[model samples]
Target: MAKPQPTDAQTDAEPENTEAAESEARDPAQALADIEAAFDAERAEMRDRLMRALAELENTRKRAEKDRREAAIYGGSKLARDLLPVFDNLNRALNAADDQTRAAAKGLVEGVELTHRELLAVLGRHGVERVSPKPGDQFDPHLHEAMFEAPVPQYAAGQIIQVMTDGFRLHDQLLRPAQVGVSSTPSG
Candidate 1:
């Protein structure tokens, strides 16, 4: 038997089908490389997201730790300030004791002094400090409140002439400003 010759329509259709098949066919290595490229892109995206999440978690943890430390340091500031009057009274009682009274009741005076010292020690242990500005010290508005102004020959302008009541601080925060008398130049 003889092979049949192709018609014009059949010839045209054969080339189109062969082109489609050629376009669809790919070598094994090229296909594998394309698949690897896609996988790598997905992995990189996942890694970026994970890194961002980890950074956010670390920031949150640091903020929480700082807040906890601040709370611990300043938690009792109000109560500490409220109890300052008690400290003042103790000092007043000791100061009011005259020589006759002290000599008459030596043990009582000693006991009061001891109690005052112990209370001060306790306050110091809790980071509360007495701000006692001596005479002629420079007046600091931030730590001292000027109740009055005086003029004298021995003191300069803006000097602390007297500290009426001691101030207090709790861990670098001032609970109360020291009541003071500031000195000025003698009035001409």
Candidate 2:
């Protein structure tokens, strides 16, 4: 009997079977690589989100701290401003008193002076300071408010001719601007 001949279907099926086996053999390595890539992508996304959250938290904390500091520094501003007129009145009384009357009222005058000094000292300790501009000094719009312009030949234009009210500062911030008179040259 002659050996059985291979059929056309069997011949075609043999190469296809071998190719499928080879593909199956590589599947585990491919799956592992895919899983590692997926894990890396997930980790990167999580890290980015964490960094963003941290930055936002830091910004919020800094803003809150700044607000607290400002509140503490300027909380008494209204009360302090209200008390300034009292100080002005006290000074005016002292200035108007005659020499003999001042001597006779020495104890009362000393008490007022002491009170004024104590008030100033307390204000200084809390970062309050006087802004006393001298005549002929260059007028600063940030620290001085011009109430009137005086024509003075002795001073240059825009110079401070007189201070109507002394100014005060709380730290580097202006609490009140000095009421001042500025100089202007007369027209030729």
- Model 2 residue 75 CA deviation (Å) reads 4.5
Clashing pairs in 2: none
What's the lDDT for candidate 1?
0.92
C-alpha lDDT score of every prediction, in listed order: 0.92, 0.86
Flag regions of model 2 displaced more than 4 Å: 1-26, 68-78, 100-104
- TM-score of candidate 1 to 2 decimals: 0.71
What tens-digit string does per-residue lDDT give for candidate 1 at 63-94?
Answer: 99999998899988888898899889988998
Predicted structure 2: clash tally: 0
Candidate 1, residue 64: how far the Cα is off, in Å: 1.8
Model 2: which ten-residue window has the lowest total lDDT? Answer: 86-95
Model 2 score (lDDT)? 0.86
**Alpha-carbon deviation at 167 in model 1, angstroms:** 1.4
For model 2, give the RMSD to the true fold.
Answer: 5.9
lDDT of 2 by residue, 70-102 (tens): 989987787777767776777677677788977
